[model samples]
Target: MDYSLNEVQNSIKNNFASFCTKEIAPRAPLLDAASHEQVQTMIKENIKKLADIGYLGLAHEEKYGGTNLDLLSQAIAGEEVAKACASTFLSAGASNGLFGMPLKMFGTQEQKEKYLPGIIKGDIIGAFGLTEPEAGSDAAAIKTTAVKKGNEWILNGSKTFITNAPIADVCLIMAYNDREAGPGAGVTGFLVEKGAPGFVVGKPFDKLGFRGSPTAEIFLEDCRVPESAVLGQVGAGFIQAMQTLEYGRIGMATVCLGIAVACMEAANAYSKERKTFGKPINRYQEISFKIADMMIMTDVSRLLIYRAALAKEAKDPESAVLASCAKLFASESATKISSMALQVHGGYGYIKEFPVERLYRDAKLGEIGEGASEIQRILIAKSILSKIH
Candidate 1:
């Protein structure tokens, strides 16, 4: 029930905000408009800056050159970065905690030693390859297969809609080792290096939002990796992916909360300056109501995100349910609030000059990625029914 952030968390939030304002905010638009190489250069520069501030691995263990902070701290920092540019935030999030955490948590000591240091240092990027062309919400039905061949595993399948895949140096890929055993018993995870033969990354995708962060399809054709690359035990990949996403949902919700705040601030500022009927737009009940709703939704979303983070940090069994609830409400609310902010801006909102337009685009990805709002609702219902039964 305690919602107070500790000193370290507060400092982290402040430092990240300062860094974003100074280093990221100014060039965000340029990066969004730049060519692929230019965008990559900008990302590298910012990532180095982020690493210098120890923001790259905020949630990892201190023993591995990380801050070892709790979930709330991670969420708070994510919010700051996301507020600057959702794509940049996605880049950092995927590298630090989303795809890398499971490896750090379940990988062998050799695997950790090989990947964790580079990831923590921000020298390399990582991605999770779970959602395939055919399997997104039905993760268990993934058709990617990895057949055991003596000391190596032959992986052959394609994963689409993989965030950070285009630039990732490593990937945590999920595949079926035994189709007959079903999702829980047949699935396994592998640590696939970028240069491994038969592992090909497709071209970057054009998207509605988060344009700075590229996503693509990853093709694994007879890809062979050592048995040591297997993460945890065979047939446990589904659970690992689910567990990782539970944590990822908290981060995604935090990003949505940030977008919501950005929408409200922009709307409030514009309403005051924009005049109608010989007075400021704020005088109008219609505009005022929209702003009020935006404020209310943003605040509520923040609380839900914080609650989920707290539950995760406390290791409560309900953490997954809370995370799902937060993700569902906060992401959907962000979409709604951003749309309203655009409406408040009138013609200006639709133009590229205003940040609200970009924010509106960014807010939509939250509703679709990191488990869609519909998927979150399904999770919530399952959780409730499980308890009831």
Candidate 2:
């Protein structure tokens, strides 16, 4: 129960922060403004830098060519990357959590042997395909179906709002294997390689935030893969997706915390110089109160994020509950704090020239992605009731 970060974690946090400030922060705005091709290039180059430094796989085992760091290190790494640029963080986040971990956990030795080496080397990009046009929070409601045809399964359906779809070399797609068993019980997971017949990448979608990361629709029409492509077993996709989301929530919370910290830092620096009524605006009770609340929330979020990370490292039963709580509180708080920071900046905040505006926009996705805030609350309540009963 040691709350203090060890020397290694402290050094890692410091190193990662320095790297983000020097390497990633300067290009963030430009990347934010670039076209899809330009942004993709920038992200690919940055991913190489991250991989070279061993930051790309903080949570995976060393034998898999990862750093094998614990959850705390992973959280710290995520926060640093997020602080630089939320989109870049998300790009790596998908590779690390949704793609890399699942492969390590459920992929057969052959699957891992085929994928992990390139993934660890940053030679290929990975994506997760679960959400469909009709399925957001209701993951089990996915309509994508994989029907057995001889030795192969034919997949048909479409997914929207998928990040990394445009450039991904591989994807982990979930679909219904037994329509008769209903949503959760009938589902299965599969790894579909790029350029598979009948599998096509759809056009990119314009999004409100995370503009630096490309998102697209994914269409599968009679996309066929060998039975060996199935991940885990039939009827296990729902459970696996839920598990992936548990880890993904922790990563999302860390990203939100980074935004919260950035908002607080911006507000603090502005308050000291902003004058109102011939006095510093920070001297005013109204302005000071907002700053105080932002600071308090940021601190609370950091602790919650750390606690969730610790619970995950310890393999505690409550890790899932903690992860959901952290994601819910930190994301909602980021939205509030970022908005307030913009208010502190006055009219400039509304302008695209200011980073706060983008941060504000980015903060919103934290509430909607991974799992929505409502879903997090439902999960927390479910966990609580289980303990009570």
Candidate 3:
């Protein structure tokens, strides 16, 4: 497989790199210290900036005001942005990946026109509510219910650890329409707008990193939406969520790859400058070896992430397996590389003085979110075993 990026892809990479340096990097630390409400405000403001630059819709349809870029381009955009700030990347990338992509794939024409423009135009923020207190990875076991009431569907449940939930203007929430039928046949996705009666958002939770990106619990106490709010078909939400997650895992791989690359960069630069025994630490075998390992891990993660994104671009049959492979490797590599990067920075890394500390904290989420490492392994094994059978 070719490793070199084409001119268009390179252009996307360069543009986002510039955006990160000029706009995101300078603000990352400040945002990290901001209050949750303030961060939510910045997320909305950042969305407008991204939309103005024609980024929010890069991989969407041109008729819907997107640039019509491919999945690889979108991944490149995310990779660059994440290098500067994980929170910014999560906020902006989720706008399209976790939110817009599903709607595009499943929503009706009216639904598309009604919501996509505002999202693509940065008029509203979007969220995906699937993980519950009881349904983190075992989504099939989620107890959230949606019962039909005349021409409306009433949703009743709670979702936790939901990023963007606190300030989301719109959300795609998953619930079961038939408790006896199981998720495969009873699950459904609903488009719930902000201020909907009975839809309540909890206070944002403080976290180790991605401080500017908020996560919260949401309660749907008989929250109601018209039948038209159903995304795709009733009893199809589980499958739709699985497919959406495959693509989201690809985006997440790039985000983790970005963090990994940042780890390598921070370690490499620090090693050269931090002197030991009146000489640069980079000269020492221990320091050099750490850098070497970090470099290798980062590069390998890049290969895996790009491979998955390119597979999606080419419509490869192995896209699902590759996405899981990429997410698993890249996320774990990020944690390892970030920890090493922090170690290289010594005591300084333990504080907010350096970006490595933030990266170190943010990297942990890579292993846990989208899908955990264990879940990815299960998916990969399932893929291989199903083929053999």
Candidate 4:
């Protein structure tokens, strides 16, 4: 019930917020002018900067180049960085949330040592490949195949809508190893190094938002890796992938909370300054009510996100369901709150110069990314039904 941040959490949140205010906030506008490749380069530069400050390694042990912070620190950092620049924040989030965390959870000690240090140092980026052209919410339907050939595995087929596809130095590629064994044991994860023979990065797509984060396709045409490259185990990829996405769901919740907080602040500032008839719009019940609603929505979202993060930190059995609920609620709240904030801004909100404009564009992705809203509901329903009777 005590929602107040303790000294450590407060300091962690403040440090990230101050850093974003000084660095990410000022640099976001330049994204409008930067080319696609330039934005990607900017992400790499930001990664190095984060590495220098030790923010990139927030959760891992010291020996693995991390500060060993808890999950709440990551949640706070996600919110703060996203508040300034969702795109750049995501560039890092996908690396850590989707790739690094999974490696930590499922990789062998040797695998961790070989790949994790570069990620912590920002020397290279990592990616996760699960969503394929034929698969979205239905993860089991993916057609990517991994055929074992002698001492190696040959990966073929393509993955679409992949984050960091074009730029990631390493990727956790998921493919069907044995379709006859079914989704649980048939799926496998391969650590595919960039530039490996037959590994191809597709062109980045032009998207509505998060333009700075490069998303593209990956085609593995007989892409081969040593048998030792398997993450965790050959048949447990499905479970690992599901668990990884639980982390990502919490991440997306944090992202949504950040956008909603930004939107609420912008509307509050604008309402106080903009006049209606003679006085400020904040004086009007219409504007005041919207502001109040936004505040309430944001606070509720924060609590849910915090709970989910706690569940993740504790390694709770229900963490997956909690994550889905948190992400679903927070993302919907963001979309609604961002629109209200835009309405408060009137015509100015529609233009690119306003941060609200950026927020509006970025907010929509929350509903679609990680796991779509519909998918979350299904997971929640399944969890609830299983608990009953």
lDDT (C-alpha, whole model) for all candidates: 0.86, 0.87, 0.87, 0.88
TM-score of model 4 relative to the true fold?
Answer: 0.98
Reference-based TM-score of each model? 0.96, 0.96, 0.97, 0.98
Q: Model 2 segments beyond 4 Å from truth?
A: none
In the range 121-150, model 1's lDDT, one tens digit per residue, is 889888989999988888887999999999
What would you estimate as the lDDT of candidate 1? 0.86
Q: For candidate 3, give the lDDT.
A: 0.87
Ranking by lDDT: 4, 3, 2, 1
The 10-residue segment of model 1 with minimum total lDDT is 37-46
lDDT of 4 by residue, 7-60 (tens): 988988899889888878788767634788897888888777777777779977
Clashes of each: 0, 0, 0, 0
Please give the distance, in angstroms, between residue 44's alpha carbon in candidate 4 and its true position after superposition: 1.1
Pairs of residues at least 3 apart in sequence or in different chains that clash in candidate 4: none
How accurate locally is residue 126 in candidate 2, as Cα lDDT from 0 to 100?
85
Which stretches in model 1 have alpha-carbon errors above 4 Å?
A: none
Model 3 stretches astray by more than 4 angstroms = none
lDDT comparing candidate 2 with the true structure: 0.87
lDDT of 3 by residue, 1-389 (tens): 57799998898899989987888778888888899879988877776877888888887888888887888788888888888888878887676668898999999999889888888888878899899998888888888899999999999999998888887888899999987885557899999998889999999999988888889999999998999999988889998998889888988888898888888998899888999799998998888999999888878888888788878888898999999999999999999999989998899889898989888988999899999999999999999898994
Best by lDDT: 4
